[model samples]
Target chain A: MPEPLFLLSPGRSFSSVVSTMIGEHPQCYGLPELKIFSADTIGASWEKESRPGSWPMQGLKRTVAELQFGEQTDKTVDAAEAWIRERFDWSGRQMMDWFQEQVGDRILLDKSPANTENGANLGRIVKAFPRANFLLLLRHPRPRGKSQYSTISKVLDKNGIGGMGFEPDVEWKWTGTNIMARQLGQDLALGQFMHIKGEDLLREMDLYLPQICQWLGIRDDAEAIEAMRHPERSPYATLGPVKAQHGNNGKFLKGPALDFERLATMPEASRDGPLDWDETAEFTPQTRRLAHAFGYR
Target chain B: MTLVETRPAPAALATLPGPDKPVALVRFGDALYVGTAAPDPMGRGRIWRMPWPAGGAAEIVYEGADGSAVTDFAVFESQGTPVLYAATAALGGGLLLASRDGRGFGPVAPAGLGQSGNLWLGPLAIAGGRLVVAAGSAAPLDPEASGARLLASPDPESAVWTALAEPGFGDAENSAIAALLATGAGLVAATANPLRGFQLWQMDPGGGWTRRLTDGAARFSMNPAATALSAGEGELLIGTGAPARPEAEDAAGPAAPEVIALDDGGAWETLVGEPRFSPEGFKVPFALQAAGFGQRETACVTAILTGPGGALTVVVTAVTGATPGPFGQPGLGASRLWRSLDGGESFAEVPAPGPVLAALATPEGGVLAVAGDAGAALHLHALA
Candidate 1:
């Protein structure tokens, strides 16, 4: 059997795009984050539920909306959510079993970022599927923080959830989450695990895309290369209901180029900016010194 | 002289029934209870309890209905009645629950516990009729400066808890209070700090606490924190360390947290080091509990070892690993039974039928080992 590829990253680390690219390879099939492993227990109900509001389910919904609905409007997204609620009835394990069935003898790609938060659960996954490989996507602390705040805020706004009174400090959460994931991966000696930077993925997709495919034992052919070039073709591209206008002049469904300059100047609570690259980056001195010493850095 | 015949594999013991999210097990009377995390369907958490000797089936016992997870549990008997206490954290508050029936539990809200940051209550023990509870900060990612606090329940039946003393143990952040024992001297608490290492704290009845022994970076890795505490024959025994940390070229290998034997007034000494037969790199110790023997000085060690395959292997370690073999091999079967004739210096395999999940020495020298996944059966092994 082909080994499953697990993508480990914090929320909003370009996992959707990269995972889709890797899955597009002929030998691979990218999966929506089933998130089955995080449940305290492995059971039928946990797999069937569509946790729409959660980060894991949102990623899954986006993928379904883009693939099944093909529309980015609020009305279309809502319809897609209803569609999912009505149609899918499987637990995370069942979903994985289905994936295995669909891509018989082919490598499976799991793209859930939340799984990084759980060590015991992750350990269970590796134990259950010994051949699984992990691809850890890293992002610059400041920009990543900015992206997370924007994304979380947008989600809250769209769902009509009121904004938290406190300005979101993305740097703190991002750095903390990354540090945890890094420590867990190291502690487990996950031999199949590899780390990739989000900046590198976005700036040099052409070069790195094929490398990822090759690492997962997938053939990087022309069709796959073209598919990688057009990530909008990913099923998750336009998956959710578009949020109501909140003065922000950007489409929530579209993946926009990260504006590093604008992000750097954002308030500490906003983007957690001026993220002294050497300090905020995972395994950097700032994170290592300030955070609990996991001996990873 | 003729050699003694080896006993057959012991029959499977009763299994505990409930959600399989790793559990905290406590035995009171003929009943055993496993405390587990039952987060609300909406994502909050509550404590779920199920009868031990029953497979993993569960019924809600205490609802943090407010959004906290019931992280730890302790059970003790007051005047022949079983009283249960649980530590819970949710919605920015920490609380302890006390129960008379062990089923209908009520909150033991103390006047001023620490703020509702990540904290958990662990190991409930009764000595001299006082209910002693240990509280500590949750894990590394949660927060720091969270030391372990002791709450004394004057009346285990009353839902009132008073802070008796603080262990003053250095930041227990990212570690759990493995086990607590009431020694003739005072109280000894085993704590594992995943990053800083593991240490044993000695607390005097008068309210002074000091570090007894500090091992060099041996407890860090992924070893489970201490879980069981018991006293026998003037020696204190502690079961700790979870599955070993898997070996990596860049990562540290597993550190064998042990079931230690501490002298009457002296510090702790290692009785069982990390088991040599454990899966190559998995460091976490699976399960441990103390068993009582009639003579007080003779106690048995019942422990579960988790291997790379996620299989639970049970073994009985005596003073040394020299215990007679039972099943095909030691430490490889689902569970094996052993006896320690000379304290815990060596171990010999007993005729346990199948893999056992937990074992507690009985007052009669016969051992009671809990087996099956999640508490399925209770196996009784009688020793002559």
Candidate 2:
């Protein structure tokens, strides 16, 4: 069985696209945000929660149906749900190992950002896949943090749900991102963790795409690199079956055609936080230091 | 457990306006005060006070801020006056204390739920001769202050609230204090959101809290929020929801309806196993999976009543949905009534009510079941 490749981050990073792009490799299989590793046991994963607007298991059911049953129908999705219910008491390790074994030699590219939020989550992954490799995907805290702030508040407001105020949201963005930094940087061996920036891959895909392939030691052939660049061609780039309609990121699912124009709108990284969310706020000195450590200016 | 036959569909007692959402129910003096969110979201709330067994002419006792919603209730009788604490859901509503005063309610607790972290304000009880209430952060994303804290107040007069249980104690499995019961063992609390297993926390003599992990969770336990807890024949009967997980469902298959009984002698027994229902004249499993049939989340015991002659009645409501997961619409949230003949050794379903969100024992030797949402009603039934 091929070891899984996990994209670890606090999201709003280009994990979906990057993970999908890597999965586009002929020898690899890209997975949606199954988030199968967030909980210690398979039963625990059902109780796991994330910040608002997090993707649910509709994607996982869809992925399982498409990959295992060879087709997407109401029956297959129902069977997939039943299949999941059947393993209610399995440990997270047992479930992940089963998935890896089922995939056989295909490298499973999983871009589950929540796995990097807590040290306990990372600890579980390390214990589950001793030979697993991690891609520490970083998005500039300034724009990425702002995006998260607006997105979280917008969803809460739209749904009539209550949450922390603007200032706390900014602090949360900083704190969550910092936890990601510490968890991956501190827990893993030097060689096991590879850091990458979303900006580099978006603006300079031709160069960085091949470079990433080389680092992972997958086929560096022209066809393989070209296929890797077209993440939109992946089977999960659009809405899935009726029962499991979402198998990928909402952004990527809508218009997966990769373009660099969105990167132009992002402001330069800043020491000060999104002041609109918090006027009297600045990143903690420790958070700032960690940001710099991630090669952010 | 024997099959208790059907009586009749629970009939409505009174009619209220549409979109009236109930928050909390409390019995103060001879009146049962019901907290309801006004029809208009921005309108002031109305507290309806109904006379016990008489059950006629429910008059409005007090009206609160426009668009305010009540979440929980607490009874505090410290400063010589028995006061009912009504916790408003959102911050703007604040907390209201209802007494037999001129207006019936006044401010008692502050309103700052999402200000610092997730504010937990329930599982109230009288433990260690003090009024105990739970307050903590429930936000899973907020690493700091993201668990439960049991606050103890010596009397209603004292403003100081000391920590009875350490913060983060209920956060072991994203579990927080969900239900509280005053029992012979001690003031007990049940936590929610199961992983390793569910547990019950008990108040000790030293003014501290201890917990007992519930049995039957092999790798992970059900997020059993003890919605209904009753003590009878020196045993505690618990009704809870298993909360079906699409990813990590129980290996025994999806959890069926269940109730657990804890004996006064420190022995815990599973009163109800993987629960099954027989809605007279229909095969429950086939009926539930049929096209028009509705499937709900794991069974949630809503209310348990201890009647005369060592009999116990447990009411369960399964919030059925058109689809699964968090986003599905609850098409048919059904609540059923069950009774145990010999203590709580077993139970039988009595076809009586719809999704009964709440049930209260009436002074007339019967149980008053409040059922449905949107089209809501109050029903009266005799148990045992």
Per-residue CA lDDT of model 1 for B1-384, tens digit only, reads 112233322332233343222234455444455444432222334444444443344455666553345545566666676667676544454567777776777765651244344255555665545777666554211213254566676675565666655443545343555566777877777665545545667766566777664431233332325545666566666655432222211223223335555566654544554211111121212222222111111112345332122222234322112111110011212334445544554444556654443444333323233333443344445433
Runs of candidate 2 exceeding 4 Å displacement? A1-297, B1-13, B37-46, B63-68, B92-96, B101-103, B112-120, B136-146, B215-219, B243-253, B275-297, B321-332, B373-375
True lDDT of residue A177, candidate 2 = 56
**Model 2 lDDT tens row, B1-384:** 455443322222244445554435666666666666543345555566666545565666666665454445656775677777665433242343446442367655445322343243554677667776655443111112235555667763445666767664635554555567787678887665443334666777665666653422111243234555677777777666544334212121233445666666555545653211111110112111210111234555667878777776777666443222111112335666667677755455667656665566655444443534554455555655
Q: Which residues of candidate 1, in runs, are more than 4 Å off?
A: A1-297, B1-22, B27-30, B37-82, B88-95, B110-114, B127-129, B139-147, B156-175, B216-224, B242-249, B265-268, B274-338, B350-377, B381-384
lDDT of 2 by residue, A1-297 (tens): 767888877777777788888899988888877766678666567557433454347666777677778766788888887787688687766766666777778888888766776777777888888778777777777777777778777877887774644333554555565455544533454335556667766666666666666656678789998888788888777777676776566777888877656644555576655355566777665455445434354
DockQ of each two-chain model: 0.02, 0.01
The window of 10 residues in a row where model 1 chain B has the poorest summed lDDT is B320-329
Model 1 DockQ class? incorrect
Fill in the DockQ of model 2. 0.01
